[model samples]
Target chain A: MTVAIQLGIIVGYLLLALAIGLVAYRLTDRTAEDFYLASRTVGTIVLLFTTFATLLSAFTFFAGPNVAYEQGPEWVLVMGLMDGIIFAILWYVIGYKQWLLGRQYEYVTLGEMLGDRFASRRLRGLVAGVSLLWLFPYVMLQQVGAGTALQALTEGTVPYAVGAGLITAFMILYVVVAGFRGIAWTDTLQGAFMLVTTWIALVWVLAVVGGPSAASSALEAEAAHHLALGSDFYTVQWMLSTAITIGFGVAMFPQVNQRFFAAGSKKVLKRSFALWPLLCVLLFVPSFLLGAWARGLDVAIPEGENVLPVILAEYTPVWFAALVIAGAMAAMMSSSDSMLLSGSSYFTRDLYRPFVDTDLSARREDLLARIGVVGFATASFLASLWNPATLFELGDAAFSGFAQLALPVMVALYWRKTTRAGITAGILASQVFYLSSLFTSIVPSTYAGWTAGLVGMGLGLVVTVAVSLLTTPAPDERRAIYFDGLEAD
Target chain B: MSRPALWGWIAVAIGLSALTIPWFLWGDATLVAGVPLWLWWHVGWMGLASLVFWLFARRFWGLGIESDSDSSGGSPGSGSRVDAGGERR
Candidate 1:
């Protein structure tokens, strides 16, 4: 496959996605519900695939192989498989509760859930602010991945800026015109391509490396540290940290929360949750195996990051190579669309409507959301042009900040007596702690900074709960406003 | 509180986490594709977790089990309006 053919295939895929979005637009009214949640009509299958696609982005596809290459076998043990289990548990324990609440309230975004639960406009605003901030870096990561793919497949024929711009332009147009409905429908298609690409690459890589049995034997005979799990203590600590970061952080991600709200019903959400893990195997497992096999083949590449995909492109036939390239592109675009859509929704529904103009009509709000989507996509695309030195590090830092939301948001959901003062204090405390840890020398590393942030959040929650109980309770009517229609009988 | 359900989920989660941990795969095994069987244990654990989640969602949270009441229309105490009077009544 020449660079020209690869570019053509990617361009075709983008056009097909845009057409799907346009079709969805014609089928549904351009109202807030339709723009935000596809009128909450997403069935179990669409929801399931979209959720899976959104979660497993270019980061998983590109970085999983790199991590496996560097960390030896422990990468799969500590990060790969453990992360999946964490997601499952998170879905069962926290996500189910969120789904039930989202259905009950018809929540549009995560900020709405926080505001309604804690009864604090400021807290809601704070959440919206954080969401918008974190989404920029995340969207930038996808753009960088897209740039990498274009550069690799084109053999540097196209410049990085041009590649990123084209991808971002296509995404912005599709999203602004179609909204969540457009993104979800396109994700369903992209998700299918990703699964097929992954399976094919896995089998082809294994065959080239002389099958799984031969590959394993070759790896075992390597240097002493080849298959070792590294330091036991470090491995356990890394695994635990990775699990917590991904489990709680991913659950709190604005895009994932948006998906929770988009499900047509609790049943749809739950069924989707059940089916997503199966899809994850097809998406994740093969990358680890392929990366390990590449290492055994002694493909000398750049250390840390550039090893896995480069090896694949170097070793595999042009046709299979094109498929892998397509898969990587699929991963990047699927995630980028969801992030752009979620960020735009936060800006329109959470930030703009309530604070800027409480009386903005539904029609005006929908228009504003479309405009916001374009603006955010443009800004994120510009940011992606910087081509940050460390994509995974930036992602980890952003997720750590997102994790700070867990305590305040969770308490507000289940704790009826949560006070506004506590919620505000909690958000401030967590943000301050996280920002300080991030910028200063206080925390030694990313994990430590996350620990400090979690501690601050914990303390803030204690104060919020304690003070609310001691202070005069919010008016019963006010409490009932949140409880709305739930029955006690 | 549903202790059985809660504890069951906790136990299963812990068991799955343990399965992914490399302690069980400590013994020397032939490496396949430059990865030991122990390493593949992690993949197996993830696969199982995914399977369990799928099953739980299908069996317990499916739309088929839900009551098909027409609750889309506003119900009593829908609370769309914050207050009836000019005051916060």
Candidate 2:
């Protein structure tokens, strides 16, 4: 009976999500821009919540608590407070320029704007290629989270493969039918649900663990190391690097970049970002605290992603457990749909339309985007079923890859001397060094507190600047058109 | 939204990150309001971040007067087809 109830709750939530997609479909126009970009009509509340929910992915739902469970409360520093501030700044820094350029050129994808700016179709393709490469793992992270959450919630009755398959199928349909408008609406709902339920879970856990004072004392007695940042893993250098990489990565994620263009107005975008840190605190602090409290309660969590389920199932009521699991699944699905949409946009708009057929009609382009969505989701789902690595490891690798692009992007936007060759070289150097560090032992992933990704970013910056000085600048016409009205009055 | 003001916020963000995360300050055996001192310190900073971001957003973002540009090549002096705010003419 309990298992059935839990599964029913999850199914009900998924259905509600699909219904929103249908409503979005009815409202959507036939244009490719409407399908992929939601006609650029998203308001402040929807924009804030969609961006918020998309940013809080399965990794935050699963891996965040896992780290806190293993390390201590300091995990909050990495994703919660530090990340919150860093990302708010980045949104202002990177997103403002992106929005201006996107509006000026009526661009539907970042690649389109970038290619035009550099007068290099190859550079555009490279950006899309790099984004797709890293995005694959992140898309798979959601499948893994959904599959594991269902399997655990049903006590293995549903199975991991089935759980993952259900999410992928639903998300593909959702993205295909609803487009960006539906995504924003559903994300707002799911984001609010997850945030509220997480707080409720926190309060419930504090009560069950004999109150906040007792929980704190229990942790201090049992796991004092988790309380501080001096642990081997939480070295100053490691913390700084992790925060920097993830901050930059969040700003560069294609889905997030696209959201900058979805804002109905600049005021809407600014208001959303202004409130972002508060939302981060509300969502992340509770999850980390729940993890720390698990240590106090002596929960045995071999897999960190299982922290939420194991604790909720054991300590809380059956209904509460089911609701929380549904919320976690919501976080995973919301993130997955956005990634699928963005990845397909990159493939269809950036790669396919440009290289294969320059004259593809808007209707045909929409069809191709839907096809790309299915293809990409299937690939990611298959990868998730293989279960190659833990969520934390895969997420870290993917984030580092995106972080490497952040510097090049900033330079391309703000620096007029940035040449196509210099930007291309910068991206290549970063990827080569970063990818090599992952596979080989010649360089450690982290040494003296700096991550390979951070080192790669530094190298990429130096190479980019040097190559720019050595190469000829972009055409005077190109520079003038790109930067013409972008300056603040 | 002057260049120096923008740089100031960046400095504050980095400085706060450095001061908040290291073990020398809030990492010890202290608890406030039944939470670790470090955890509370972060909570405090989240508030500060909200304020700073709000101020930055109002003054700095999207301040340029909207201009019209054609879809053709984004070339300057082309006939205007849409304004800078991204709306169609």
Query: DockQ values for all predictions?
Result: 0.22, 0.32
TM-score of every candidate:
0.87, 0.93
CAPRI tier for the interface of model 2: acceptable
The alpha-carbon lDDT assigned to residue A35 of candidate 1 equals 85
lDDT (tens digit, per residue) of candidate 2 on A300-336? 7764347888899888998889998898889888888
Residue range B11-45, candidate 2, lDDT tens digits: 87677566555356644757778887777777787
Chain A superposition TM-score per model: 0.91, 0.97
Worst 10 residues of 1 chain B by lDDT: B80-89
For model 2, the stretches where C-alpha displacement exceeds 4 angstroms are A302-305, A474-477, A487-489, B1-3, B20-26, B62-89
Name the lDDT value of residue A103 in candidate 2: 70
TM-score, candidate 2, chain B alone = 0.55
Q: How accurate locally is residue B80 in candidate 2, as Cα lDDT from 0 to 100?
A: 38
Best-matching candidate per lDDT: 2
Clashing residue pairs found in predicted model 1: A215-B33, A216-B31, A216-B32, A216-B33, A274-B54
- Provide the TM-score, chain A, model 1: 0.91
A317, model 2: CA deviation in Å? 0.9
Q: Which residue pairs collide in model 2, if any? A: none
